[model samples]
Target: MREFLVEITTTIPEGTEPAEVDRRRAAEAVRAKELAATGNLLRLWRPVGELRSIGVWRAGDEDELHEKVLGTLPLRSWMTLTVTPLESHPNDPGKADAAG
Candidate 1:
């Protein structure tokens, strides 16, 4: 599996209904949990005072990550994402653990 760092910024259109926002947020949480269970989503964080999220995710490839995983989000249409492909490092802690 390959890892990616994804930064997501969400923007609700002007005058969007509050109920709609709530529904999508709820659904997004559910979907995130499901992704984590499947080992696709590794970690997620929201920077203080920001309406955005950053996450580490795993996938077979970039296309699969975007099309299969991220595309499934309830707020996909409302989000702008910057995805960076990650390469494993020899000195990575996870690699050291496995070697030991």
Candidate 2:
């Protein structure tokens, strides 16, 4: 499986009520579980900087990732989305140099 980073950006429309936000949050939790069950969930980080939430996922390909994201309604509606492949990192801490 290939790894991907999925970014989600939420836009709150003018006059969007607090209850609506709460409802969307609840719905996102359900959608998260669905994504996890499909073996696509890796990690999700809520925005702490310029970008929105970052989600690491595993999928057969970009198409499958797009399908999964698009198929979920509230999530699709709330955020602008972007996906990029996670490249292999030779310097990854998990793969230390044997010579060391």
Clashing pairs in 2: none
Taking all chains together, the TM-score of candidate 2 against the true structure is 0.74
Superposed Cα deviation of residue 17, candidate 1 (Å): 0.6
- Candidate 2 global CA lDDT score: 0.77
Clashes of each: 0, 0
Checking candidate 1 for backbone clashes, the offending pairs are none
TM per candidate: 0.93, 0.74
Native-to-model Cα distance after best TM-score fit, residue 78 in candidate 1, in Å: 0.4
lDDT of 2 by residue, 5-87 (tens): 87778787779899998898898888788878887787889866664788898878888777755456465666788878887
Those runs of model 2 whose alpha carbons end farther than 4 Å from true positions after fitting are 49-51, 95-100
